[model samples]
Every structure is written in C-alpha cells, then in structure tokens.
Target: MRPEAEPAMKPVFAKIGKPVAAKFRPDPFQLASLEAIRDADCLVMAPTGSGKTWIAEEAIRSVFQKGGRCWYASPLKALTNAKWVEFGNHFDPANVGIVTGDTKENTDAPIIVGTTEILRNQLYDAMHSGENLNCDLVILDEAHFLGDLDRGVVWEEIMIYLP
Candidate 1:
C-alpha cells in the first residue's frame, strides 16, 4: 500500500500531562474502572484526556501503599520512559524503575515501567521457570495496540498469562 493509503496514526503524546486539579474529581468511567480493578483484571478504554492515566496512577498507588509491586507496560519504549518519569514524580523516585531494550535501572523498585515486549518476555520466562510474576498491579498502557498486526501478540500473551 502507498504511504498515504495506510491509516493515519494517533500521536503518542503523554496523557498524564494534565496540570493538577485543585480538587480533582473522578468521572463516572474513571470510577467504574477503579471499581472493576478492585476485584479482578480491568481494561479501561476511553478517549484521550479522559483520566485513564489517573486510574492507572490510582491503581498503582493502591499497590504501592500496600508495599506491593506493579508492572507498567507501554507499547513503545519512549512512552515507557515517560511513565517512568511521571511515576517517579508521583510515587518518589526511589520507588519507580525503568527497563527497556537499551536501558535497565532500579529493577528492584516497587513500581516498574517498561516496554510491553519486556513484560511479555518476563512472563514467558516465568512460565518456563514455573514461577509467577511478582507483581500486584499490572497496567498495560496503549492497550488498543492489541489490534495491531505485528505487536498485538505480545499484549495477548501478557493478558493470557498474567495472574
């Protein structure tokens, strides 16, 4: 297909960039997402700037508060880097870590932000080794990519294996 014949791509700007609200209020969908997360796995789908990241932050915060671990997987390494910084700022720099194809740091931190491929690879290793992923909260950002022709399998595998 010609370049212009292909579908236009959505810009991967950070949705976690909104300025802090003085008295932030959760929208209904945000509330619903949080409610669902408390019991079992949750997949939050919403328009850009609709507080999905806030739901993720809140979920991570809940696990952090309990001294549990979290795995945040982004579809791209760059977005993984952004979440690393954003999470570090929100939950203390010492608690957040980054792992991508080229960089790995603070792997022992309670909150881990990395590419989906790394997370998927970790799950595979865990499965082969008969070990479970030591994470309490698992957030898969850019989950819409599960429809992608190439990288969707990574997302599908992670979802299937994550307990």
Candidate 2:
C-alpha cells in the first residue's frame, strides 16, 4: 500500500514591529447607550468583544456619584463572580459585594453582583414582605439569556416585578 500523504504544514507569521500604544476612547454607540440609560431603560445589543461592559461600568459610576445603589445580575454564577471582582477593582473592594449560592459577602454594600436567579428570588421575597428593593440601577448582563426556555421565566419575573 502507498504511504499516506503527508499533511500540509501551516505557515507561521513572525512577530511584527513594536506595538503602538493608542489612547483610549469610547465609541459613539457606547456614549449613546450611556446617555439613553440615564434618561430611561435601555437595551444594548452588540457583538462579543465589543465594549458593552463599559456602558454598564459608566452607568454604575453615575449612580455611585449620586450616592445611589446598583444591582448587577448575570445569567451564570461564574460571570457574577468575575464581575464582582472586576467591579470591586473599579469601585474599590469596600463598595462592591457579591451573592451567589456558593458564596455571599458584604450583602449590604452599595454595589451588589449576583446571578439573575438570585435577583428574582430577592424580588419574590420583597413582594411577600412588602419591602421595596433599595436599588437605583439594575444592570442585567448577558440579557439575551432571558430567552432561555428553562430559566427565562425568572428573568421575565424580575423585569415585571422590578421597579
């Protein structure tokens, strides 16, 4: 039998010249979304790797500037944990807190991060106890997950019950 054909070798590119440092600037779309969020509810849709998270960070900054509280919800616990650490870095560890089924810390902090399911449960508790959610801004990351058949209802309930 003839020997099997050798696989083609892929080309490797050499490192280019020194990388240039570019000044940071916000995209117009990000600016527009931030403005809209200040006046009313806004839904931002963008591809992955886009600066969507920056919009959330700016919004949170505005609320904190006014001495207001914020709640950031993500569809996954891992995302929540990551954001908890990130926002902690941005706003200082003393101001940021996180609550997941596996972990809970500084529950009374001004900036709270947790899974959307936890937020929905908090809403249920608030309704039953007749207490208002003391939050000025609610940032739901990966909001498209609201269409998930299994957990979509929780997100829907949060939208309906959140003030």
Candidate 3:
C-alpha cells in the first residue's frame, strides 16, 4: 500500500486526520448519553424513539476523536446494514464501515456496524487464536435482546467473554 493509504486508514489512531464530511445533531437524551459514554460502561435502556441509536454514534465519535476504534454490534443483519448506511451518509464513507454475513465494505473505517453473531464469532476466534481486537469501545444496542431464544446464547457468550 502507498504511504498515503495508511494515513487515510489511520483515523483509528490519528486525532485529527481528514475532515469528516458530515455532522450529527442528536436529540437531548442522545447528547447526554454520548457525553457519558467516555466516562463509564453504560447500559442505556430507554424507549424505542429515545434516540438509543445516537448513543452508539456518540460512542463512535468518541473513539474516533481519541484515535481509537469502535465495534458497533447490532442484533440483526438489517440493523447492521441500516447502521452502515446511516453512518456512511453522516460520515465519510472512507471513514465509515460495515460487515454483515456476506457484505464487507471499508473494513478500515473508524466507525463499523456489524452483526452481533459476527462480532461474537470474531471474539470467540480471537480467544482461541486470532488478531486481538484492540478497540476502545463496544456498544451493545437493543441490550434486552438477550431474551430471543434463537440468538440469545450468542449475546450471552459475548457478554461472558468480554474483557
């Protein structure tokens, strides 16, 4: 890769690299959650329209601001794709990314939205033998999804293995 290529991908490590093209104006609750995400491990259990997703965006921005990375794990493939598209529009696609069952784009983006199963599998493989995920944050949206019998175990396994 060219020298410039590395710098472009280094938003995960660069404080102020290329200017991100878009801006986000989150609601009050999301703003508050965003502000608090840096200080503690948060469990945001709010109503559906309470801007819970923006909290994840704030976590993404925080990680990028600190020269770190965020892994946005969602419960469903549709949610993952939706987040990927949403963030892509709000941020430079080069700096935003996605990973689903069959679709992987801009894997080097500072912000990444993916499926919980994919993230869990990666964590499990990492535990057994893989590249260490040195991310600065992990936002578990729809936290109450641990009740779905089909995919609940994956979520439980992820919570158990998180370090």
Candidate 4:
C-alpha cells in the first residue's frame, strides 16, 4: 500500500513574530446565522454587504477542509466571474476553477465557481457520460432566482439532478 504524505506545518507566528489565529468576533446576527447554517443548507435573505458572503465562505471552507470539493453556482456571468476572483484568493488558484458560458478554467479543480446552467450542463454530461464523481458540495449562492421567469429552470435542474 502507498503511504500517506506528511502534513505541512502551519507557521505558529506571523511575519511580525506574533501568534497567528482566527478571531471569533463576528457580530451577533452573523454569529447566529453562522450557527444556524453550520450543518444544513440555508436560505439567507439579507441586504448586500451585510456579510452574507461570510456564510458562504464558512460553508466552502468547511467542505474544502474535509478533503471534499465545493461547487459554488451563481445566476449571472458577472457574479460567477466575481466569485472566481474572490475564491481564487482564498484557495490555491490551481485548486480553484471557473466555468460559465464564456469562461472555463481548471474544470477538475476542487473548488469550482460557475454559473448555475454551466453546472447543470456539467452534471448532465457527467450522468450521460458516466464519469467519475467530481463535486461534494454545491452552494447556490443567489438561490432566490427560482422565482425568475427566464432562468429558474437551470437552478431547478441543478438542485434536482446533481449527483
């Protein structure tokens, strides 16, 4: 049997020589919301810049840390591009990828940022082609689009047919 690789050590001290750590200083509502969505899918309905992205970050981090892949889907190409840049900063670029109607990079990456239709099409392809599994968790970031007249079908397809 092949042996496992050794884990890399995280720097105990920051560049300034102080201990590096995460501070749990989220606001009351943020804390409550984080706790509420820790284990299940959430329907966050908050104003923009109210830290809704933080919840998505936490969920993505949780999945990635567990040695699993996360597929974050958006309704708009602009949002997909924005999320690609945002998540690329957090995860390694090689491990992070983007896919949309016009953009596709690192399609096999662990963390994928894509439009809902792109993901749906990928899922459909995977099923029809019988490819190996690729994703573990999928976060529909702007999930309220199920009410939209033009694009709701794509999101519904993803939610209904994802493996």
TM-score of each: 0.85, 0.89, 0.76, 0.75
- List clash counts for every candidate, in order: 0, 0, 0, 0
Per-residue lDDT for 1-163 in model 2, tens only?
A: 8864345422222235467999989999999999999999999999998999999999999999899999999988889999999999999999999988998999999999999988988989999999978999999888888899998888799999998
Using TM-score, give the best candidate's number.
2
Off by over 4 Å in 1: 1-21
**Can you write out model 4's per-residue Cα lDDT over 18-130, one digit (the tens) per residue?**
56798866667776766776666556788878888887887778778999898899988998999998888988788889999998899888899998888888888888898
lDDT of each: 0.91, 0.91, 0.79, 0.81
Error of 4 at 124 (Å): 1.6
Q: Candidate 1, overall lDDT? A: 0.91
Model 4 TM: 0.75
For 32-93, candidate 3 gives per-residue lDDT tens digits of: 77767767777888888877876776677767888898888998888888888888877667
> Residue-wise lDDT of candidate 1 within 1-163, one digit each (tens)?
6444223332333444667769878998898899899999888999999899999999999989999999999988888989999999999989999999999999999999999999999999999999999999999999999999998999999989997
Error of 4 at 28 (Å): 4.2
Please give the distance, in angstroms, between residue 116's alpha carbon in candidate 3 and its true position after superposition: 0.4
Q: Could you arrange the candidates by TM-score from highest to lowest?
A: 2, 1, 3, 4
- Candidate 4 lDDT trough over 10 residues, lowest sum: 7-16
